[model samples]
Target: MLTIIPDLPDHIFGLRASGEVTKDDLQQVLLPGLEKLSEQYKEIYYLLVLETDVRNFTAGAWVQDLIAGIKHLTEWKKMAIVTDQKAVEKFTDIFSYLSPGEAKGYKLTELPIAIGWLSHKA
Candidate 1:
């Protein structure tokens, strides 16, 4: 399941993912939010919180995410992922530096800090 985080300004979009995420979830929940943000802002700050309840993505879902990410690569200004998964943390730490947009990963406990950093002006 997925839920959009509330209380953020229009330019900031946040989503929390739990349990199994499928392509339909992306289509129904995330895509609409992204489209709305694209219409309202030149660039978007996206925060994704992946809790322990979030299981692995299905193959179709993973493909959709990759395509979406590539499509909006330059539209994103900042990406903050809050996850304590060791592999996820390591991957983000290693590759975020190479990404076009600023990206960072924080433990779930630091989600507020991640949100602050993503929403802050550079």
Candidate 2:
């Protein structure tokens, strides 16, 4: 499931992923939200909180993710992935430079900090 995190600044987009993530979640929730944000802001500030393991994500969900990323290859300003997995967190931090914009990983406990970072773009 993919849940939208609300009450964020208009320039920031947030989502929470839990349980079995499906392509439907991406298509119905993520894609529309992203497209809406893209229209309102010049650069996207995406915050994703992962409550489930990546293994739980359906293959189609991964494909949707790749497609979305490619579509916004140069449209993001910052991205923050909040997860409890240490390996995933570390890897996201190290490989973020290759992403379109500045990307970072934070432990779940640091979600507030992540939101702050995303909003300020620093």
Compare the candidates by lDDT and give the number of the best one: 2
Summarize candidate 1's per-residue lDDT along 83-115 as a digit string, tens digits.
989778777777678777887889999988997
Q: Which stretches of model 1 miss by more than 4 angstroms? A: 53-55
- C-alpha RMSD values across all candidates: 1.5, 1.0
- RMSD (Cα, Å) of model 1: 1.5
Clashing residue pair totals per candidate (backbone < 3 A): 0, 0
**lDDT of model 2 at position 37:** 88
Alpha carbon RMSD to native, model 2: 1.0
Per-residue CA lDDT of candidate 2, range 2-121, in tens? 999989988888999999999999999999988998988867899999999999899999999999999988897888999999888888888687886888999999999999998896
TM of each candidate vs. truth = 0.91, 0.96
Model 2: runs farther than 4 Å from truth? none
